[model samples]
Target: TGGSNAFAAPEAFQTRSSSRPSPPPRPDLSSLASSAAPEQHAVSSVPEQKAATEAGVLPLYKIALCCLLTDLKINCRDSLLVSRAQAPSLPGYLDLVEALQQRVAAAAELKDVAALCSVFSGFLRNSLLPSSCSPDVQVRLLHALAEVGLDQRRE
Candidate 1:
C-alpha cells in the first residue's frame, strides 16, 4: 500500500502545472518620454496660470475686512455710544477694542464661539487685574462668565 501511495504522489507531482500564465515583459518607456515633458510643463505653469486667472478677484484680507465691518455695523449699531469725554480714560482702550473686534470677526468667520471664549478666558487669567476690581471691570467679567456658561449649556 505504501509503495502504491508513493508511486501515485510522484505521478501527481509530474502532472502538476502553473495555475496562471507568466506576465509579459515591461514595455519600453522611451516613447512616453516626449509626452511626459508636456505634462510637466503644464504642471509647472499651473500656479502662474492660476495667479493670472485670479488677478480680478478681491484679496482675501479685503474680503474678510469688508464682511467684518458689515457685520459689526449691522450687529453693533445699537451698542455704539458717543461718550462726552474727549479721550479714553484707559491708555490702551482703543487697542484693546481693536484686538477684541478682530478676534470677534475671526471667531464669527470660523463660526467658533468656544475658541473665542477660550481666548477671552486666557486673557483674563493672564491679566494684571486683581479680584477686587472696579464695577465696570466686574460687569465685563460677569458678562464673559455668563457667555461662557451659556456656551457650555448649549453644548
Candidate 2:
C-alpha cells in the first residue's frame, strides 16, 4: 500500500538553480577570506627578481637572464615566462652565469666582514634591483630589504 507514494518522485526533484544567480560575496566573508590569506597584491607583486624566481626554471640562470634583460632595457618579467626545459636554448647565458657564480664564490671565500657586506650590497644593487624599475618600485624593494639589521660581531 505504501508503494503508492512512489508517485512523489516528481516532488523530490530538486529545484534548478539556473533561474537564480548566486549571491555576491558578502563583505565580511570576503574580508575574512582575505585576512586568512596573504595580501595577493603584495604577494603577487614580483619586485623585479621575484618573477624570475617564480619561473622555477634554471633558477640562478634565469634570474641572471632576468637581470641581463633588465640591463638591455628589456622587461625581465618576460624572461621569467620561459619554461625550464627551454631555458638552456634561449641564449649563451652560461658565461654570464659562470662569472656571476664566480663572484658568489669569491664572496663566499671572503674572511672579512666589510668585504662580505660590500659584495652583498653590490648584489642587492646590481642583481636584485634593476635600473629599469620605477623609483617607487625601487623604494618598495628597498623597504623589504630595510627590514634586516646586520648583526654586530666583534672585529
Best by TM-score: 1
Model 2, TM vs. native: 0.19
Task: Provide TM-scores for the models.
Answer: 0.23, 0.19
Compared with the true structure, all predictions reach lDDT values of: 0.38, 0.35
Q: Which window of 10 residues has the lowest lDDT sum in candidate 1? A: 1-10
Model 2 C-alpha lDDT per residue in residues 32-122, reported as the tens digit of each score: 5544436553544555566445444334443453454344223433442243233332233334334443443443222222322332343
User: 11-52 in candidate 1: lDDT tens per residue?
Assistant: 333344233467998888666567555657455477676665
RMSD of 1: 27.9
For every model shown, the clashing-pair count is 0, 0
* Cα shift from native, residue 48, model 1 (Å): 2.5
> What does the lDDT come to for candidate 2?
0.35
